[model samples]
Target: AITQAEISVQELATHSGQIEASNKALDDIAKQINMFALNATIEASRTGNNGQGFSVIANEISKMSRSSHEMLGKVTSSLFRVKEKIDATTAVFATSHAEASRGVELGSGLTDIFEDLLEKANAANDSLGSINESIQSQFSSLANIQNSSEELATVAEKNAASANMVASVTEETAAAVEYVTRSAMELTRISESLSQSIPTAKMFDEWQPDDSNEKASQ
Candidate 1:
């Protein structure tokens, strides 16, 4: 848009040049007309009273030329002002174009930076996803380990119970062996006392002094 405005301003400057040229041509024409009027007045004076009407016509022509010159001057001044404004407008457009171009370059740079940041963000998201998966896998493995540990604990508890049962049976067997040993000692003492008491019964013993006493002594 700025470029188009600059072009338009340049075209206006060209038109102003053309208008100034035309104004100069008009001024030249006015000068020629004024000179012709002066010459006509000189000829009218040379021709005396009969040239009075001709002299008045010459004066009117001169006055018209002067008016035309004054108008042309005003036009020239206006064209100068218009040219100055056009030049100023053209400068402003040129500056605006430069600024706009710079702004576009900055915008493009910002876009590239934003794209790079977006790519990095996506990569970060992918990395986080991978990390989350890894953590889940580790949790699964830990769960399996915990389950195995619980199974081992159960087996250990069963083995401990079986060991406690065996220890109780062994204690009962020891108690029974101690009772049998005591009974054997008491029986031996009773047999020795009977051997001594039987001698007091000599008469009966003699009557029965057969293999009984011999077997007992043997």
Candidate 2:
């Protein structure tokens, strides 16, 4: 369970990093769009009567670029918060896994102790005939050991149950990480699609990294 959680965390970290890079690229492209729009507006204004349509288009483009920038900013902030939560959850899972492993070890050790106690009890019974004078006292000791063993067994059962529950929760978390990975990929695709519609976007695309590493199969 610990190993699985660790793998999930590593994948989540990689996905988060890819999303961060894409967001940065989107932001850069949006800024360039805004700059182009601003220059177009200036040139349109200098053209007198013939530039009204161009000016209106430039104004709309500027507004769109600003809106895209703001939207990306909000998304980036949200992703940061999500990454923080995932980190916290990963820490929690790691702690739980450690505790569960320790519980199993302790339970196994207790079982071994109980088996030794039982063996000793049987040996005592076998020799009871020769020591009849102290038979009652030896029987009492055997009963106490038996009772203690039962209680220890019960405790071990409870520990096993707790460990199972932790494993189940870890599986659910792994599923959530998978969902997040898909969502991040979809966001990347949408960002790319949006960029293609903007003027001079190709230049910004050229500035982006190959992204092959980011898109490698999980």
lDDT of 1 by residue, 98-149 (tens): 5444443334543343344334323433433443343334234323323332
Once superposed on the true structure, which residue ranges of model 2 sit more than 4 Å away at CA?
1-6, 99-218
> What's model 2's TM-score?
0.43
Instruction: Name the best candidate (by TM-score).
Output: 2
Candidate 1: residue 147 lDDT (0-100): 38
Q: Judged by lDDT, which candidate is best?
A: 2
Write one digit per residue (lDDT tens) for candidate 2, span 56-121: 544554554455445445555544554454444444434434544444333454334334433432
Q: Give each model a TM-score.
A: 0.42, 0.43
Runs in model 1 deviating more than 4 A are: 1-4, 104-218
lDDT of 2: 0.41
Clashing pairs in 1: none
